[model samples]
Target: MTFKSINPANGEVIASFEEDADYALKIRLGEKSFDRWKNTGIEERIKLILNLAVILEARKAELAKEISLEMGKTLKSATAEIEKCAITAKYYCQIAEEQLGSIEVSNYAHKAYYKYEPQGGILAVMPWNFPYWQALRFAIPTILAGNVVLLKHAPNVFMSATTLEKLFIEAGFENGIFQNLLVGIDKIESIVADRFIKGVTLTGSNLAGSSLASLAGKYLKKSVLELGGSDPFVVLADANIESAATFAVKSRFQNAGQTCIAAKRWIVVDEVYEEFLNKVSEKINKLKAGDPFNTESDFGPVARLDLAEKIEGQINFLVKKGAKKLINGVRKGCLLTPTLLNMSRDLSHSFTEELFGPVACIITAKNTDEAIEIANETNFGLGASLWSQNLEEGEHLLQKLNAGSVYLNSMVKSDASMPFGGINQSGYGRELGVYGFYEFCNVKSYIIEK
Candidate 1:
């Protein structure tokens, strides 16, 4: 079957491509290629990885445009995403030797050390949001460490998937070092079961992660999942109200409010709750939602009309359950304006669900204890941001949060220097930093008697 990537900003067909008709043959080629690639030295891999940053910079404008057209994100944000991916590629190159090289485990008991060996092939299931950025987190580190990859990107961003494949090819990757497959999700189960695919990494919703992870588990293959999140932005009484409110707007509304790490729930202490609400409402009112290609637009489409519909349904459900809208806004096509809601603390849908759009739901807490209680009440434990003037107290309270990462006074974001992942239903395994690159490696131990 053929697929066409439709521009959400204007509903225009950007490009059409046929799906991989012979995935079996593709997997065979990938497996065979991995056999050869696995033996390559780390020095050669680093050289090729370093070249990616140069290539990405040369074509940054064109690539950023492609991203905006396909996924309907603001041009500025799209460019930032691509630039971050480029930076991450360079970072992996810099630490590859030290991170993946052999390490002495025991020097006296014979000669003993630990070596990182590559698994044959991996299947990457990625989402449309931050398409290039999400995929590169796994692709650069995995491919640079000497493993072949088959990317199963979201159908809506197939243009991005193919574009990235071209980038790797231009950057001197081997034929099967990195390839994009346009097949449907149903194909993933069978692909994972294939002897060639040694592991799987996915960045998507909780439902998608669960189904795919279970299938991979059945096959006894390693799996790393970066799933959904209901991240909290907590505002305490002692916080700098103006600064906290500004960052709250940024953390919640950036990327049109379609981020897993975006602050979806605002749990504020009662002491300054009203003042914080007024600040956020004013900022939300000033946001301009328009065409993604427009440089000055504050918000853009949410990737797909169906996804927009899903978000509206979520909002309506919460509204019926006593969640009242403060600054009501409507949705047009895939573009949703900034919406603010005063969420009920009665265990309603707003607190119990993941709002994956521009709908900001606020809940007032009696004190700091209640704020944290509300923050940790979700099934997702991805990330959380705490706001407080007492930085040391914020640090101590941060431990009470049950997420993979916690920021004392900033938005939770993925960085090449820090390990990023979540526990509980948000999924397992980590990405980024030295810990991220080693997720797919076979840490083999070797010892020789003297």
Candidate 2:
């Protein structure tokens, strides 16, 4: 099978490449390179990562263009994404030594410490929606910890994948230290079963996570999954309605609402529901949806036509089930206007489903307690943003929300300094921070007694 890198905005094929026919050879090369890479000094590894960061910074313009052309994100957003990758590389480079350093477990009598060791190759199944950021967030730390990487990126973003592989080599990494396998989903199981592949980490849908996780379990390999999300954006009566409304639009509409961390559901307390709705509706109307290459456009089209169709189908299904379309969204091929739907409280099933496009579902909550209840009524616990003027009360309410990360008076985001992942169907394990750096490491304990 051939993977075509098509521009989602205009449906033009930018490039195409045949699937990697010699996948076995690629895996073998990864196996050979693991020993050499793992044995390299941490200082040298950090130096190479810094070099990679420099290259990412220097070539960000061309790289961002490829990303925007392939994935339909605005050039500004794509440029920011590439810059974030570079910043994260530098972040890990600064902290890798301490994060990966050995820990002393015993202070008296006998010497005992816990040391982190790389466990060969890790297979990363990355998604296309923030293609560069998604792949590097996992790869940078995993590689810095001395493990080799085999990337199986989403087919639609194969061009970005190949470019990433080239960047690694340009930074002076050995051929197999980081390899991009162009094979499809069918080959994932075989790759996971390979002795050279020690673990698996995937950032995609729940269905994809389940299949690959089962394979990892069968092969006795450790796995980390960052899956889908229906994260809620809660607004209280006393909260800064204007600021909350502004950030809400930014969070829900950015990336054309394709992000896993994007706020999919909006739960506003009845006390300020009308005010919040009016502000958001007005803000949504002003959004400019146009060519991704245009600097003035606030957002671009959805990554593909099928994705737009799916969003449209989901909106239609909800409208049939008694959901009110407060602000109608117009769809043209891959471009979709920002939409707002006022959802009834009884629509429990739709609340659980993940909606991936630029449509925000608004649910009115009677009060703060009810708002919390509505926000927690989903299978996804990825992330949530709560707005309330009462900092103490909001801090206390944080314990009640069942999410991986909750933000007060701010939008939900994944930071290099924080652990990012979710609970329940949102998938387990984490990415970023110290926990992510140690996910694929062997935490071996060393002890000696005289």
Candidate 3:
């Protein structure tokens, strides 16, 4: 089926792309690319990615505008996302050699070592939220490790997908090192089932991740799925309410709250709940939501109309379920107002479900034990944040939180230096850091007798 990507802000058609490749063709292309890319050394792959990073840095303004226009992210955030892509690419390039190099081990047996080798080809089903960054995070490492990639990007960000393909080509990459497949969702199962695709990686919703994981399991193909999150932003009684509130606004409202790692649930101790809420409300009120191209704007429209509607539905559902609305919801075109709900009970649908927008659900607890209980109640365990005046207290709570990463007095965000992934229904495997690079590699142990 052919789909057209429209501007979420005004419902204007931005571009229409046809589903172009079938399973057989995708398999053939991937196989062909693998033969060439797999033979290319890590140093050569690093050079190609470094060239792409340079190209991205030079055209940051142009690429950022395209991303903001197509996805409705603020120009500033879009630019930052673009810069992140470049930085990630350069990071992988700089470390590919050392990270992927052979490792030596000294033991009782004569000589033993291990070599990190790449898988043949990987199928990447990327989301549009952070269009450029998500794609690069997967592509750079996989390619640097000598693996070719087949990208099936979200339909809404087709232009960015095509632009990414062109950037690789311009960077002097061999044909097929990275190819964008303009295919519909129906074709994904067949593509994943293809023998040429050694593995799969996805960054999307929980349902999407589950379905893809099931398919990958059917074929016993390795997969890394990074799904939705209801990350908890905990504020202890002894914490700095003002500082915590400032970071809370950034964690919740950044990217219009489209981030998977974005802090969705705020669990504040009753002792400081009033002060924390006041400071957070003030910060949210000060944010400017308007045209993404406007320099003064701090927020932009939701990625699409459907998403905005979903956000509205979630907020209204909470209100109808008897949750007190501290800040009422608002929508203008595709833009959704920042909303905060005071959820008193553990209503199944209240703050438990993932609401992918600028809505923060505040749950009050008497102490740290109650706070940790509420945080672990959700099925998602992507990431969580804890705020406390005592560093030891924050670290202690961090150990109890059932999440992949925990931050102390900071927002939950993915960094190249840190491993990023989720536990439970948030999906499996990881991305970023040395562990992420090793995710796509086959660690082969070699033993030599003296």
Candidate 4:
């Protein structure tokens, strides 16, 4: 099958490529690469990854443009994403030795220690929204753990995916360390089911994550999925309204609201609901939606025209369901204005659905209990933000948010040092920090009798 990558900014065909890998070839390459990479010393792997980090920094601008042209992320944001990729690589390079160091445990029968051994070739199915960062987040730790990578990147970011492979090779990595399989979604099941592929990691929609998880389970292989999130941004009556509203707008509108953990629902206390709404709406209107290549543009076009249409469709549905439109939903090419919808009813589609654009659904709550209830009503449990002046109340709400990560007076974001993942429909297993490095590792136990 042939896949054509279209520019999201104006719907022009940027490039086209044919799917080239068969099941047999994928299996063979994975097995062959695993044999070499799994046995390579950790120091050597770390050295190569550090070199890749250097390469990423030197060619940051080039990679940023590729991301912008292919996926419509602003050039500035794309550059930041590349820099984040370099940071991820550098993080593993600096800490792999200590992080993966063998830990000795005392036992009654014998002295045993756990050795962090590679789980062979890992299959990463990444998303286009964060073309580089998503891939690097998984690649850095997996490679540093002495495992080979087989990336089946999002079809839209094909050029960036191939460029990443070249960057790894240029950094003096041996063949098979990081391989980009230019395969379509149809080919993923066979490649993932292969006996040589040890585990799978994905950062995409809930539907895709569920399908991949089911496939991985059919083969009894390990899988880590970071799926969709309808994260709540809850502001209490005692919170700093100005600061909370500012962070709320940034959280919901960043990446044109394409982020998985973007604050989709804003639950504000009735005491300050009107004030918060006015502040947030003002900020939203200030965002400049234009060409992603422009340095001054705050918002860019959605990754694809279809996504924009989907978001618009959701807005229409909300309008039909008695949602009062606080801001008019309009589109120019793939660019969409940041919109706010006040859902008239509590269990409406506008309040329940994951709006993957700059559409924020405001739900007014009487108090803290109501806010928590509204926040946990969604199936997703990825991330949540709680804003309050009271430290005790903020901490208490964090404990009750039902999310993997909770922030107080801050936006929801993943840090390299923190373990990031979710529960329920948001998917399972953890990524980032030491936990992520160990995900693709084996913990074998040994016993001896004296």
Measured by lDDT, the strongest candidate is 2
Residue-wise lDDT of candidate 4 within 121-214, one digit each (tens)?
8899999999989999988898888788899898988989889989988999866778888887888888887877899999998889999999
TM-score per candidate? 0.98, 0.99, 0.97, 0.97
Expressed as tens digits, the lDDT of each residue in 124-182 for candidate 2 is 99999999999999999999999999999999999999999999999999899999999
Deviation of model 4 at 181, angstroms: 1.3
Candidate 1, superposed: residue stretches over 4 Å from native: 348-351
Q: Single out the weakest 10-residue window by summed lDDT for candidate 2.
A: 344-353
For residue 410, model 4's alpha carbon misses the true position, in angstroms, by 0.8
For model 1, give the 10-residue run with minimal summed lDDT: 344-353
**lDDT digits (tens) for residues 1-450 of candidate 3:** 677888877889988887884546756877888888888877778888899999999999999999998999998999999899889888887787898888999997699999888878889999999999998888888888888888989999999999999999999986678889998888889888888788999999988888899999999899999998889888899898898999988988889989999888889999999999889988888888788888888788999898898889878888898788888769987998788888874763345678888888888999888988888888899999999989987898799999999999888889888889999978889999987677777889999997
Task: State in Å the error of residue 53, model 1.
Answer: 1.3
Which candidate number maximizes TM-score?
2
Q: How close is candidate 2 to the true structure, as a TM-score?
A: 0.99
Instruction: Answer with 2 or 3, whichever has the higher TM-score.
Output: 2
- Give each model's whole-structure lDDT: 0.88, 0.93, 0.87, 0.87
- The clash numbers for all candidates, in the given order, read 0, 0, 0, 0
Q: lDDT, candidate 2, residue 176? A: 94
